[model samples]
Target chain A: MSEIVDWVAVDWGTSNLRAWGIGPNGAVTFKKTSPKGMGKLAREEFPAALDELLDNVAPARSGPLDVLICGMAGARQGWLEAPYLEAPTDLRGLLDGAVRPTMPDPRIAPAILPGVCQKAGADNVMRGEETQLLGLAALTPGFSGVVCMPGTHSKWAQLSGTRIEQFSTAMTGEMFEVLRTHSVLRHSLTGDLDGPGRAEGFAAGAAAGLDHPEQLLGTLFQVRAGSLLSGRQPDWCAGYLSGLLVGTEIGSNRHLIGDQPVPLIGSPALSALYAQVLAMAGARGEPMDATAIVLAGLKAARSFAA
Target chain B: MSEIVDWVAVDWGTSNLRAWGIGPNGAVTFKKTSPKGMGKLAREEFPAALDELLDNVAPARSGPLDVLICGMAGARQGWLEAPYLEAPTDLRGLLDGAVRPTMPDPRIAPAILPGVCQKAGADNVMRGEETQLLGLAALTPGFSGVVCMPGTHSKWAQLSGTRIEQFSTAMTGEMFEVLRTHSVLRHSLTGDLDGPGRAEGFAAGAAAGLDHPEQLLGTLFQVRAGSLLSGRQPDWCAGYLSGLLVGTEIGSNRHLIGDQPVPLIGSPALSALYAQVLAMAGARGEPMDATAIVLAGLKAARSFAA
Candidate 1:
């Protein structure tokens, strides 16, 4: 097939790098991914890793091919430092602060977009999520309301139309992992949270977290206590823990959410869980596909640059 | 220099075994500690570990010497299971539930005291803290107040005279360890919290936790954000975490504390921190020496048996 590649869209995160080849018609002609993310690469290794991924993929060109990148690639320790653009920032203007790193391959022209930062109360920052937000904005133009992007470090962003007014980060997922693996709660928690008992436990935990977030320290020990006293299963314990953390996150940030339905941008499974918990808290969670939003975000940024 | 031993008092926990040689006149003639706690010993290994620690200390006798033990030695997986006594339990009656484990040496007749359990509310259990509570009760003959025992798993007990009304456990220390070693917050945390910045951070965290315990999920990330934005030192982050957890613990269980001073039974440094935080929460922390209370408790129990 004789294809004329117009541009490339790359999501260079901490642990993974994904790229999609865009044709002149703005359609994805080819897609590829690698584990050589910003976390594994030094500043000197970025160009080679990019070249390796795009070597046979990019069409023969007389000049450098334009590549638009987002995420940790623009972090201080990534391929090149693309300083954060402080909020309230317009999603369309993300490409304005894009930094161009020196490339070894003359046929590669990469522009890394800057992440978002909140300089006010409880200062916060996000790299890749900014693009995800941009993608969400692209999918729903002039999007307004709270956007929850759940992950290892879950981000809660307040959006006024297409501009991010402010944002907050919660260490819920990370906290859950640490407690489940390294704390005494590990004794009572095992296996994945897939059972019915886990689901019920999750709901109960979410309720407890919402009702008594201050009681987190006391409630956590209940995993072991319940196991010893009532012979509660490991799955239930895991579910309860998940519910508690998610519930606490939602409860703590409920003030940020208005009457508008909260849009959760993340993996389907995680977003579903968040949705379930949000429903329990008398709120709505609209699950949005992460990949779709990310691609849309990169495409929007590309068009804005052009 | 010849001495006659009356009985042995032991605090045999999960990680360490501490014993005191009681003289005929109720004085501590010898004190020793070992890492051969219940966690390190199998059912058969317990006799040998105890013998090693008790060697050349017991008086020459054909009959087994009476040895009173407390803590994890009475757990289900310990030498012999000394089942838990449900609350509301009388401190003086702890010996009634003591179980004697079979020993290899005829000269070692060890009796393990049962820990207390609360089957109500959130379902709680404690092995060593019961003994500590007994010690606290012995120190204050008619003690009627909330007792705070801080450690790996901190316990807060409501005591009326010699009876334990109810108790709650918080995995504060364990949570701290997990967050510091395994969580993403570890990146912004390190070293002992001793600097001025750390103290300020600790106070601020404690206040935040006490004032708005619901904000824990959001507040935890502030440690990292502050570190990234304002160059917050590692010690400050550690101190802030410690304060937040401790403060939340106190804030959550504030209903347990009346107008009376809260007796804090633990080590000096930990007790001091708790005391400071308690003062911030508008409660007084009366620091009580742990060893003194434990010895007093054992002595009282010994006399009761006689």
Candidate 2:
């Protein structure tokens, strides 16, 4: 087992396949990724892809290797279906089990665990982000704040003493796409602009939305008419639209999280964007290094198993 | 004045200018248009653009000209600033008056009137489309129904007797543009579809939204997660997304005009699209002839003035 030993942690997602190899000391020695995302691969193809990566990291005689996996790859559509855990769960209870790709050698991957969610009258489920959250909790002891992970559908997970209390997902980014590119507002703004801090228009939009969300559809028309009739700049209107979405999300979830500061996990650009908007709403937030958090989660799992 | 009359109506809008010369009996003698749409011209350039078009059709040397102008050119940003009229107004009362460039001969151009919207304490306003509604009313008497003019912003207006009783605008089309081009959702969708009719994924999206709006954001993450995990088809997801926006519009406005047949005033493609949706919701509808409606509004104004 020692001869075949190497770092093995999987970032298995629906469309992305990523795995890393680390030394015994928890240092990443090498990493590999492939197109064999969970969504594309057939059920039978799972073990082969894992082997393709493991084959590079451990090429010696056959021996057992410690492995860990996370993400949607542990989902129903993944190689080994992992059932969801309810919210307020510890690390082990949050997951079902990891999958071992059926290999000819019968030496397959370890089981992955799924994330948990809890909402009355709603079907709540999460997969990979939970590990990141666990990693986050490991890195920052006694962090009872909001962990916001931004994406196509951004999730705001509330944690209370290492247990995920509750969470909500907002479609602001997706709605932004719908409004900017596919909708009529495209004619008003030609391209995108980036400012270091939150855009003024975004702030205005959020404030307007917080004031009256019911008038959202009607107010958007004024963006075009305002430009056509009053020479309102299109770029500003774009920013305003962004504010509306971010503001709306905050308005919906603000009460749920209380006045706790938010810890953002994601890429730099996304975290910065969220921080800017949160600041405008008078909410406090800090950027947490996602890679560090993911590794911390892995180390915690290793320690748990040990 | 009667003998020289060729086209009696001129519709000047942003980006393009159109004029119709009529015979003595009001039959169309000639029709012409210029690239001088409101989009291309600055505020000061309006008079010159108007003069160029007049030089061709109603030259002073030819005869006395009776022309009516409408569209964005009459907006606050255009050459002649036409104040909007309040709702429940007749064509004559909505008239903002016409303008003739002082440079050319003393020619007369009738200004088109804007429609009005008064929402409680909100200010009232109107524009060129109201004229088209008026024209439509003249052509079809006792016209008491809703007119849906689809464009950047889709406007729905109720015409009672000869007055435009009430109106509302939806940013549905604009939202479509934003989502398709600007947001991360843009990445999830295939650039363009082969044809106009609903795609397969569209139905799924519609059902999803109509059945579960709360799950929208969470489900959208599947687009990215699915691609990451399972290599989900982007094209089908794109269609599904289109359905969500279209479905949301239908769902939100169901209360205002529930299952009622309304007249569609727009392009054939727009008409067909709306018809498909309305059909799904068990609502009846017919396409309003756009050219006829606009001209009818012009004729109605003439008759009302005479």
DockQ of 2: 0.21
TM-score of chain A of each: 0.94, 0.83
Candidate 1 Cα misplacement greater than 4 A, ranges? A1-3, A59-62, A191-193, B1-3, B59-63, B190-196, B303-306
Task: Give TM-scores for every candidate, taking all chains together and pairing residue i with residue i.
Answer: 0.94, 0.64
Indicate which candidate wins on TM-score: 1
Worst 10 residues of 2 chain B by lDDT: B117-126
List, residue by residue over A103-219, the lDDT tens digit for candidate 2.
555554455766565544233557778888888888888888778887656788888656787776677776776666656566666654443322766677777655544445555
Against the native complex, each candidate's DockQ, computed on alpha carbons, is 0.74, 0.21
lDDT of 1: 0.85
- Interface root-mean-square deviation, each candidate: 1.3, 5.4
Error of 1 at B110 (Å): 0.5
Clashing pairs in 1: none
**Residues B228-297 of candidate 1: C-alpha lDDT, one tens digit per residue:** 7778898788888889888888888888888888998888999999999999988999998888888777
